[model samples]
Target: MDEVLADPIDKFISLYQRDHGFNYTLEQMHGKEFGELLPEELLPSLRVYLNQKGFFRDLKVIPGAIETVEKLCEKYEVFIVSAATEFPLSLEDKQAWLADHFPFISWTNIIFCGYKIVDVDIMIDDRARNFNPKIGRHLLFTSPHNVGLTEYERVNNWAEVAEKLL
Candidate 1:
């Protein structure tokens, strides 16, 4: 089950940087004080533009996401836990976007709440800080934007992540 993760966003960033020669981080793209290149209202539109412009066309799923989730689903009840900004997106639009991008995922199992904590055995996310405190194991997906996070079980790719989970 895929989530509304920054992988698509990350792909956009890299493509934007490589093709347009704009070097910017996600924080800078969304930061309150420093996020001036794009207006707040345009952020979501920009993301959509990026998505449409082949930003996620050939994105490599985290190395181990498929295998790990496939394996874990056999033991624990695995589900997607995501937090999307309630900005210009109405709840419906956000849900629609998630649904369109991840048609293979089960919307019933998705939790679109602000906080990431849920009664679960394990959780994997790009943001380690948002992990559920009640979770026993925290698998951190390494993101180019999340380089400052170094305390968790950081895996550079999904394949590495699958190795750790298995």
Candidate 2:
């Protein structure tokens, strides 16, 4: 969720990769898409520009995120059901990252997957559409870029976000 805003250009690039069949540097695919679609060559430099401009890591954790999650852990069986894959970041890396940054989470409590829909009490995710009926409740982490999407319980901050679940 935080990454989406911190790197909107990356999101656009990722979307472009999804739409097209190539997964190379923007320069490698230059002159492919016409007009605003993006000049393949310029994408690499644009990415560099975004990085140098500090757009690469500006994601701020929602206020009270830690407190809310900690509180939620007390009342509910809290689990992080994210869409990120285990590649690039291995299980160890993922666990370490979480442990280092989100020390509040118990290692056994976290579940990482590229695709997940387990029979659990509830699920919270940025991609709310991925919520399965098998799960109890769904909370959509609404970001500025995804506000136009329809039909889900959305919350911008974790304080309001906690009320829905616990």
Candidate 3:
């Protein structure tokens, strides 16, 4: 759900800037996780922000995501799989966010768990580690942390996703 359909980094940036007065551009985050850009002492606080209630509720939807995914649904069984166990507090907010933004998707199609072990013919995610090359065609959704990665096919935006999948 994160970087793929929703802009969680925006949430992180908003809270980080409001609290620390340091604004970060996406370019500054290229090829690195958001925490890696912060001072070591501030790492714990970053985790705190992620754990706070409503942190995942209002993330901006990625451009073209809703329209593209809705189009894809016409041809495929769509799912909103999220790795939510890591931040227990975000489970509810993520669900609510999805409901508000992607109401066409059914609740039964959403999966919130620690491990993404679902068997699918194609998987789109920002994290390269989550891909099992032998299992399916994995499309790497471009995100700051995965910018340097080149092992898989990459889609930089939802429009690209529509062109490729729809």
Best by TM-score: 3
Candidate 1: stretches off by over 4 Å = 1-6, 14-64, 85-105
- What is the lDDT for 26 in model 2? 41
lDDT of 2 at 84: 44
- Candidate 1, which ten residues in sequence have the lowest lDDT sum? 29-38
Off by over 4 Å in 2: 1-60
Per-model CA lDDT versus the true structure: 0.56, 0.56, 0.91
lDDT of 1 by residue, 83-148 (tens): 643333433444554456554456776676676658877777767667766788887765544666
Candidate 1 shows a clash count of 6
- lDDT by residue (1-166, candidate 3, tens digit) is 9999999888888888999998888889989999998989999998798899999999999999999999999999988889999999999999999999999999989999888888888999998888885656889999999989987899999989989998
Cα deviation of 104 in candidate 1 (Å)? 6.2
TM-score of 3: 0.97
Please write out the lDDT profile of model 2 over residues 1-166, one tens digit for every residue. 3322122434445645675554545453232322235555655654443334233233344557777877887887776654445343344544555565567888677776766857786666656557888876776765544456677777766767767766
TM-score of each: 0.59, 0.61, 0.97
Q: Which candidate leads the pack in lDDT? A: 3
